[model samples]
Every structure is written in structure tokens, then in C-alpha cells.
Target chain A: MFVIYCPYCEEHREEEEFHASGQAHLARPLDPDNCTDKEWGDFLYFRKNPRGLHQELWQHTAGCRKFFNITRDTVSYKILETYKVGESPKVNLEDASHG
Target chain B: MDTVNVSNQYATNSVTERAEFGDSNTPVIASALEHANMKSLAVKTATGLGVTLVELPVTGMLVLRARDDKPALAAALKSSLQLDLPNVLASNVVVDNGKSYCARWIAPDEWLLSCPLQDAFEIEQNIRTAAGASSIAIVNVSGGFTTIMLSGNNANDVLKKSVTYDVHPSHFTVGKVVNTVFSKAQVTMRCLDTNHYEFIVRRSFADYVWLWLQVASAEYGISIEIE
Candidate 1:
């Protein structure tokens, strides 16, 4: 049984306490009102699902009630980083060694 | 023409200021939960500041919402209480010095500040002066919340069980403040000192958090600090 660290609670709790939110650091367009329908649709729905390393956002809805970024390998299930709600994720997959 | 002593049967239970009503009494009251293994762990600052670990009985908490754009409100708060309002994930300290204080912040045009059982009036006046007519509201949450102070060698361990925020030394250093969840309930956590932390929670959920503390501290053998 593995546990995930909750950035808000400061503890590594059972994975059940957290829900994985994919991809952090999304910025809303400055002028969403003037965007085309396709642009808005792509912004809202597109995601990068890589097989190796992935940068994702996770919300501790059952725990901290805050959002954090997690850099982990999908195959190995190894978490690289967990950052705060407003901060940026500091993971670079190219520099990291994946198992 | 001033000779009327009206009998107030209704006034007995209707104390307008909840803090003053409970002021004469003590603030920290022990709980009466029956369990075969009623274990507790209380910790305090290494420096031995009155920073203690306690599970407060029935208390009230309110989440104050206000617009930081209002200059009058900010000025009023500083002048009356000497409290610097916190913005976003930040928090401020309110005290004559470091001895006593009530840290507050701006949570998206709103602020959450807590004080002793009876300091609501002064807090109200100060807020009114600072937040002059700029779409601000103050709701008395005296009957809604409670407080718990966690201190000691393993208080952080207990907190780690319920909160998802990083409480590591690098992330949650002394004087850090966070509004997070404790178990299933939401709580505002403030690090008062190196080994001490304070949590503000709803009255209805106090029991749940307490039970959580008990279970979380099973390995640490929590020491209850009774007043």
C-alpha cells in the first residue's frame, strides 16, 4: 500500500484521501471573450497524456482542500515533486531519470 | 420619570455578546467522550511560551469576508487593533506585542480572523472603521466554531494525518498559516512556534477532529495537557 503526500496537511496519507487532477499551471487567456469557438474548445479539453513522465495537478479534496502539482512517472508511479497551489511546478522530464 | 425595573426572564439566556458571556468562565474545557482507549497528545513550544496543546470545548468561529480595496477598512483595522491584514495565502499578526494575537488574511476579498472568547466587540469596531462602505460584511460566527492548539514532539505528525498541505520544515516553517481540511472538515492552521500549531474548526466537527487526533497519535502516545 502506497501513500501520497498532501501539500496542505504536511503528511503522506493513503492515496484514497486525494484525487488526481491532471496538468497544473494552466493560464486563462487574457481575452477569452474574443476567442474563436475552436480555440476555447481546445483550451478547455486538450490534455497531454504521455506514457513516461507526466506533470499533473492534484487536489486534496478529502484532505487539504488545496490544489498542488505532482510530477510523476506513469509506469513507475514515482512522484518527483509536489508544489503549492499558486506556485509553479519545477519538474523537467528531460533532466530527470525515469525507471 | 425614570423608575421602571423591568424583569428580564428572556434576557437571562440571551446574552448579546457570546464572548463576554463565556469570559468569566474558562476557555479550554475537557471533553467527555467515553472510550476504552481515550488517549491524547498535547505539545508546546520549546521556548515554553504559553503556547499549549488543548482541545477547546464548544466554541464559535466565523470566516470574515471583506474587500481589501477599501482603504478605510485597512486604516481602521490598523489604527484600532494594530493588525495588518493578510493577502491571499499570507496572514498577519494582531497583538500589543508577541504575547497575544489574532492573525487574519484576505481570502479572495474576504478575511478570516480569530480572537479570544470575548474580543468580538473591539474587533467589530475596528473592522467597521477599516471597511467603510466598500461592499464588506461581518457575520458573528461565535456559535459556529472551535479552536485546538497542537504542540509537542509529534503534533506535526498528528496534523499530517488530516491535512494535505506540506507541513515539512521547509514548507510550513514557523509562523506559516494555511486554511486546509482536518479529516473531513475544513480548518485554518497557524504555526505559532516551532513545535506548536493552532487549528480553528467548526463546533459540530470538533469531536471528529479530536477523534482523528486520538487515532493519529496512537504511536506517539499523546499527552493531554489539562488545565
Candidate 2:
């Protein structure tokens, strides 16, 4: 089985140790009180479920009780990296294309 | 080496006196960070009572603390422990070398590195240099704690006595590690395999925990391993 790194416990555990939280890097609006209904709706519900190399958030509910990110290929189920919640992951398509 | 034998007569007492190590006046032997018999600390259980229990001896454990500012220290940890330090929660990294394994990044500023009891100091030294100039802390806690590998039939029943977390297989399967309060003590619990788990607790609390475990497993019978 694949191992995902937990930002809270700070270790890479088996995938079984984690629960997938759809979509990573989702942010709240700067001013929720001023935002439109559509902005709030998009912020709350929209996500990218691409065929390859998708980034998502996950939780280790049983282990350290923290959240982190996982970059995986949905089609192949191959995970590229698991990083901390606040930090950005290393796998960017833009960077990969340049290299 | 001294085991306080609780007669069947005193089994009714909630707080029974266990044959103690260290000072006699102390309520319980705080094996927390103390070496018990050169092997890890453990509690022995009587058989034929349907009591299910497991004991782990001086398994080595280390605690590493660092911050995001300490890039060098983090790198050193990566090279030394060979596991990535996730800045978030519920994750762990494992690297093995024959007899021992190192599990790193169990917390934001802390990491737990476990090995054979004797290798504790050496492992500490290797990581110490990597932590220079960083506001980091690495403490040798092998003395304060010992481990119990609990699994097999009725393992969950034993855990239920101490932990408030849900240990149901559907929630806590293999490879998950949790730090939770166990009765009056706090422990770092890791699910090893489907039927096995590893509980690391302070040594001073071993006797108390051991006693509580007996009460918890009054039905399944316990097996003791004396090395």
C-alpha cells in the first residue's frame, strides 16, 4: 500500500491511516460579508477533479488529528507527494513543463 | 525484578499495592523514562482468567522537536531519520534497517524515533549535530517510557479501558498512530497490523496502567512474555 505523509504527526504513514478530503488549497473569501451569492457558492462547492495529477486535502483522524495535502493521479492512484496544510506542494504543472 | 503479587483476595481493591521499584513511598513506580530490567518495562498478567493482554519491553523511542525556520535541522532529520517531516497532521514516515524502524514527524515540532534500547544514545548523537543552531529539542525518553504490543483477539476490549478514541477497525485500522489519554495517563498508540498494536506510555505509570489493563481484560485471558 502507498504511504502518505501527515503534516500533523509529521510522518509518512500507510494510506489506510488517512481519510481523503477532496481538493486542497481551497481558500475562504477575503470578505465573506461583502461577497456575492455566486462567489460564496463557488468557494464552498467548486473543485477540480482532473483525470491526472489532482491535488486534494486529507486528514489523519486516527493518528495525529491533522490535515495535509496529497497530489495523486486519479486514474492510476499513484501519489506524487504529501505536504503540510499551509505549505504549497512541489508538483506544479507549470514548473514541470518548464523543466 | 520485584513483582508485587496481588493475591486473589486483594483483587477486589481498586487501588492495590504492587511490588514497587524505586522508592516504596511512591504510589506507583514511574517507569516513565526509567529502564526496567535492561529490557523495556512491562506488566505481567495472570492466566486462565480470560484476560487478554500484551506487553512490550525496552523498545527504543526518541522525541525530536524543530520548527519551520530550521531548514538545516529539518534536512539533518531527513538524512538521519530518512523520513519526511509533514508540517500537518495524521501522517508518519517509516524507514527500516534490519532489526529496527524509525517513525518520524509525529508532531509539528516533535518526531518519534524508535529503535533497539541500546541504540538510543547513538541515534540521539547522530541527530543532535543536525540540530545545531536551531531552536530544537531532542530528548532521550527511552527511560521514561516502555511499549506494549497489543493485538490478537480482544485487543480492542483492552484498549477500551484506557482510551476514549474509537478503536473500531473501521475507524482505526493498521498503521494509524494516535496520542490520546488512557485512563489517568496519556499514551502514543500505533496500530501495527490488523490484529496488532503498539502502545507507548510513561514508565512511572506502567504499574497503574498494568493494573487498569487487568480490570479491562478480565474476560479474555492474558499471555506474558518474559525475556
Candidate 3:
């Protein structure tokens, strides 16, 4: 099992205590009334199933019960970094692939 | 606009009546494990017992939540409770006038404060008044959970076999508290001493935890103590 770091708890906890919410950083449309159906549908239902580096939202369900972000390599099953809710990840797809 | 008499309604409503005084008709408050029948399993003598398990009597618990006004809340708690807000994964306890008060850090924005059962409502009100104008939430959760003390020589061994988190003394030092999984149920565990540990488990899961402890500590010779 993965030892996931909980940013809020400031400690590494077992993966059994956490739950992976879908993709991270999904912004709602500001002008929903004026937007097209495709945009609204995409916002509601669409999610990226990226093969490489991905940012995902996760909750420490049994521990702190707080949400945070984890940047991980989908293929290698490695977590590159974990950050709090409002913070941004330092690692991106391009930096990881080249380095 | 019509004005409602809230106090009159509350006074006349038997369902919302408060039990301020005890009498022959007033029912005694029982803990969650009161009917678990653990006394039958206790050893008549404590000579060979390796682990001692005791269910603490009813305690007053409050969940304190504050996001942006944490400093204000901390000051308020310091003034009213004479205890500082604990840091991450840590707990603080204070005894004043023979009354013990403890606060365990549950999350970045939440902490659990436990005191004597009879003082819970007064403490909640005191904190609210002291933290006036500060954004905070104090919820009385005394009846929602119970504390279990696991101690003796092989107490750590029983914990190692049950919880998923590392319970080694080197990692789980004194004052450190963790909310982790214990035999499929969630428990907030705290290390009191070398071999002493305290668990706060939900009332609904108290029976399950007690049964699990009995089975896990069977090989080590478990004994129950009534408080």
C-alpha cells in the first residue's frame, strides 16, 4: 500500500485512510447562463484520463478528513508530490519526462 | 411579522426537557459498553494479566472548528480553559481544581476537547462567550463517543496486531494522537506512556471494538476493570 502524505496532518499515513477524488482544479463556468450546452456538459461530465503525470484530488477520509492534491505518475504509480488545497504542485508533465 | 415565544415552547415541550436534577425517577446515564458484560471475563486476580482494559466513565466532548480566526479562538480557549491549542498530531492536558481537561488535535482546523461530563455545557457556553465575534463552531459530542484505556505489559503488542498505523514507541511517542483504522473501525488513539494507550471510539462501534480487543489480547491474558 502507498504511504500517502497528508498535508494537513503533516505526516505520512496509510493509503487505506485516504480516498481518491477525481481530477483536480476543475473550475466552474462563471457565466453558466450564457454558455453553450457542450461547455456545460463538458464541465459536468468530462474528466481527463491522462497516461502520464496527473494531478488528482484526494481526501484523508479516516485521518484528518481534509482534501488535498497529489501529483502522481499514472503508469509508474508513483506520487511525485503532495500539496494543500490552495497550493500548486511544483512538478509538471514536461519537467518529469525530460528529467 | 409574528413573534414566537421560543422559551415558552421549550418549557412546555417534554421531549426537549433537560434533566438538571437527579431523583428516583431520573434514569442513570450508562456508557456505551455498559451492557457488554465484560466483568464476567475479568480475572479474579490480576497476578498473571498481561493487558488491562478499562472503559472510562462518560466524558464531556466538544468538537471545536475554526478556519480563519484560529488565533482568536486560541486566545479565547486560553482565557477560559487555561490550556493552549495543541499543535499538529499533538495533545495537551491540564488539571485545575481536580478537574482534568484535555484537547486533542484532530485536524488543521479541528480539535477535540474533553472534560468532566457535568461541565460540558458550561464549558461550551464559556468558550462561545469568550470567542465572541470570532468565526468558530463548538459542538457538544459527549454522547457520540467513548474512551477506552488499554494498558499493561502487552498493551503495545495488542495494538500492533490491530491498527494499520505504526504503533511502535519510536514513532508513536507520548502526546502524539492519530485518527487511524483499528480493526476496520476508526479510532483516535493517543499514547499516554510507555505501554499505556487511550482510544476514543464511536459509541456505535464500542461493542465491536471491545470484542476485537478481547480476541486480540486473548493470547496475552486480557483482564477487564470496571470504573
The best candidate by DockQ is 3
lDDT per residue, candidate 1, B1-227, as tens digits?
22222232213434533665563433332343323123333332123322235665433233565554546556666776687766545667755644344645424455666665445545665566556555556665655666777887777777776676668767787776666656677777788777688787766777787778767765666556543
* Candidate rank order under TM-score: 3, 1, 2
For residues B88-173, could you state the per-residue lDDT of candidate 2 as single tens digits? 32335464766555564465566687777656666666666665555666676666787766655777777866676667787776
What's the distance in Å from true for residue B173, model 2?
2.9
Q: Residue A39 of model 3: what lDDT? A: 93
Pairwise TM-score winner, candidates 1 and 3: 3
Residues B186-210, candidate 3, lDDT per residue (tens digit)?
9999999989999999999999999
Better of 2 and 3 by TM-score: 3
Could you estimate the TM-score for every candidate? 0.57, 0.53, 0.91
Query: Backbone clashes in each candidate structure, one number apiece?
Result: 25, 35, 0
Pairs that collide in candidate 3 are none
lDDT score at residue B156, model 3, on the 0-100 scale: 96
Model 1 segments beyond 4 Å from truth? A1-99, B1-13, B16-53, B57-62, B68-70, B97-99
Q: Which digits, one per residue and each the tens of the lDDT, describe model 1 over residues A16-90?
A: 556887776666667899988887887798887787788788876654456778888888988877878777667
